[model samples]
Target chain A: MQAYRTLTRRELARYFLTSTGYIIIAAVTFLIGFSFVVLLLKLQQDSTLMPVTELFYITPFFWLILLLAPPVITMRLFALEKFSGTFETLMTTPVSDLQVVLAKFTAALIFYVVMWLPLLGCVLIVRHYTSDPAALDAGALGTTFLGIVLLGCLFISLGCCASALTRSQGVAAMLSLMLSVSLFLLSFLAKELPGTSSWQAQALGFFSLVEQMHDFARGIIDTRPMVLYLSLTAFFLFLTLRAVESRRWK
Target chain B: MRNGLMIQVANLTKRYAGHTAVSNISFTVERGEIVGLLGPNGAGKSTTMRILACFLPGTSGTVRIAGLDVFHQSDEVRRRIGYMPENNPLHLDMRVREYLKFRARLKGLSRKQSRGRGDIVMEQCGITDVSRRIIGQLSKGYRQRVGLADALVNEPELLILDEPTIGLDPNQIRSVRQLIKGLAGNHTVLISTHILPEAEMTCNRMVIMYEGRIMAAGTSENLQRLMSNTNQVIAEIAAPLADLNECWAQTAEIQQFDVSPAEGEYFRCALTARNGLDLRPIVYSLARERGWYLRELTLTRYSLEDIYVHVTRPDEEKEEGA
Candidate 1:
């Protein structure tokens, strides 16, 4: 437990101190803030009856920022260490490979959470401008945050696995970007394909993060998407651990 | 297992992809001893060190460090070793003190202990002045010192330094050697260096390796004594070539003599002498009797380089010479 905490602290320090970390977070925050305002104002002008926050949560623009943040944020995590040859030093320490990977994964996840915090300002903006006290659905907002957190875990874990696969940060970023984009596209296809009423469609829908987002935006407390995200997150995190341990053999 | 043995590697081999890097090799280092793994580049010194340090897995055989099996009990073995790998890789963005503190904590030191040990190692490696400086910003010498400090931060029983002074200047090399020599009583050091003289100066014993195999291992005196038969006496005599030939042939201790013709009326003569025989007195007497002008007459005692060359020298060279 102490080793885990020490590595987590060091990994967090690595992210916070690096310019790339700040740049990626700042860029994602800016994009989220812009998309939030644009989506809210566009919805307000088009239809005053629809909830602006709900529409903003389901926007493709916000999801684009979500998909890009992981690749940018996690590309430097393990790839930089491998490139600099510090991974060997870190591995030779008393800590196990699992601890190193978890620490890095947790750091990236924490930063991903921080990146999503800017979107919360949209709720604040709505609350500040609205004269109606009941306009903000607190339950829906909680579910939205939960959905975002779980999705971020899955994405960041995938990105970390990609980073662990190579020493080049550029290649790592490219791989994560490609992987997340493919996953997002495949899930969207599963949601958009024919036979939406069939059990097959429901099966495909389990992997559809778009469907998950829509349900989350509506304040639905379904456990299927959470299960899917959590399981895949574990799968990728295991791969990262395996990648860290592979250095000993090769 | 010997009572006080700190490191014992037997039949340790490492094969990467298709080719073997370290062939079946064995060696031991007693506690508080400084041993050098001397070899040329690609001679598997780093591979062997990595295996002992628990950084890489050995393909076969056993490595016991401080009584812990390296492959099976690696984490325990790692806790007992302070390994400074080749190139001294470090987190360039981290401050020197911060890196040391992190390493100390990773080695399971308490927070209070981490701070104290970090300072002690920084002081020991003489990097206290630059403790707050970023690792990448420091000069190569300072960065290497920081690596050394990181290794020592854990206060482990064994220290494995791979070419610690590979590219340092003369002053830096001397300081590192002084630091290593000072560590003899406290930490058993296994240093790997391709530089022969560095090994000669820093190591108490050496294991000379070539082509992924250990050729010989012993102290400088031991290796020389082992190769005492090949000891040569070289002389440059300013006499007639025939007179020099006759004098060298008449010397009883001389086993063989090779006289090469020179540009001037001097012969560059190298005579292989018998073991433990002093041929200089006879050569001096012969020079006096013939009224010869002797330019140079010296017994060639085998150095670490000579022993390394003789042990690693190919069979073809020996055959051609014979």
Candidate 2:
């Protein structure tokens, strides 16, 4: 536990010291903030009684931030270590591979949360602008935030796994982009295919992170999507740990 | 197994797709000993050092450090060893002190202990002045020193350095060498370098390796003595080649002579004296009798380079036959 803490602290310090962290945060905030304004204008023009509905509708924009920001932040987690020759130094240390992977994952997650902060402010702005703020669906807002956080965690883990596979940050980022996009589109592909492929539908539905976000967006705190998101996060994290371990043997 | 033997290896083999990097090599380092792993490029010095540091596992063999098997008890082995690779592996954005403290923490030092140890190591490596400076801003020599400081943060029992002074200039090299020499009695060090002089100056005992095997391992004096029987004499004489060869052929101790013309009337002749012969007095008298002005007369000794080339020569059989 002490080792993990130290590693995490140092990893976080490194993230802030580099330009990547600031760039990621600024980019995500701008994109999400822009989407929030667009949604607000559309809602105002329609004069919908429920202003929070548009806020829930804007939740999908966070996925764009989730998918893009994490790869940028996490691709260099292990890839840079390998390129900079620190992987050998880390391997020779007393710390375990699991500790190293988790340290990197936690740092990326923290950065993800900070990136979400500006979006949180957007939510507060939506609440303040509504005439009847009390009518706003707090349950939907809470669930959407939870879902975005879970998806961010999952994406960070996937990026970490990709980074562990190679020393090239560009390759790691591309692989993570491919993996996240495929998983995001799995539900749509399953719907397009014919036959009694209920298994494929169930699997894709279970793995489709964006689909899970839909339930939260509609103000439903379903246990299934929550558990699914958590499991996906854990699975990818385990794969990242395994990839790091295999590097030693090679 | 005794008090001095800190690391021991037997039949250590590491193979990659039928090509062995370190093939059945065996050696041991006693406590407080600085042993040099000398070899040409691609001779597996780095691979061997990596295996000893537990950074990589051997395909087969036993590596015991501090009396613990490397493969079976890697965590324990790692705790006892500090490794600084050929490339300085560091987070360039982090401050020097912060980086060292992080490394100390990773090596199982407590929070307070890491802080204290980081300071001591930074000062010991002479990087305390740059402790707050970002690693990327430092020069290569300072970066190498910081790497050394990170390795020493845990105060491990054994230090494994792979070409630690490789890219440093003369002054940096000397300072780093002095630092390693200052660590003589406190830690058992195993340094690998293709630079023969670095090994000759810093290491107490040397292991000469070639083609993934130990060609020779002993004290510098012992390795030098192996080639000491065939003596070389460099004599500068103010005489013509004809007169020098006439005197040299008559002297039974002169096994072979190669003469090269020097300035004006002087000639530099390299003489290979017979085994166990001292021809300095004989050459002086010959020059005196011929009234040849002797500008210089000195017997040459074999250096580490000579031993390195002699042992690892491609034509070892032919050279031995000669």
Candidate with top DockQ is 1
Poorly placed runs, candidate 2 (over 4 Å):
A47-60, A195-203, B242-256, B273-297, B315-322
Question: How far off is residue A2 in model 2, in Å?
Answer: 0.8
Model 1 agreement with the true structure over B1-322: per-residue lDDT tens digits:
3249999989988899999999999999999899999988888999898888898999999999988999889889989999998999998889999889989999889999999999898889999999999998998888888988888888989999999998899898899889889898888999999888999998999999987899999988999898877668878888887877887787778889999976588888888887767677788888888898888889898888888888878854877999
Report how far off residue B60 is in candidate 2 (Å): 1.6
Every model's Cα RMSD, please? 2.8, 3.0
Which 10-residue span in candidate 2 chain A carries the lowest summed lDDT?
Answer: A50-59
State the C-alpha lDDT per candidate: 0.86, 0.85
lDDT score for residue B124 of model 1 = 93
**Reference contacts recovered by each candidate, as fractions?**
0.83, 0.83
lDDT (tens digit, per residue) of candidate 2 on B143-257:
9999999889999899999999987999999999999998888899999999999999999999988888999999999998888877888999988789988888888999999
lDDT of 1 at B151: 88
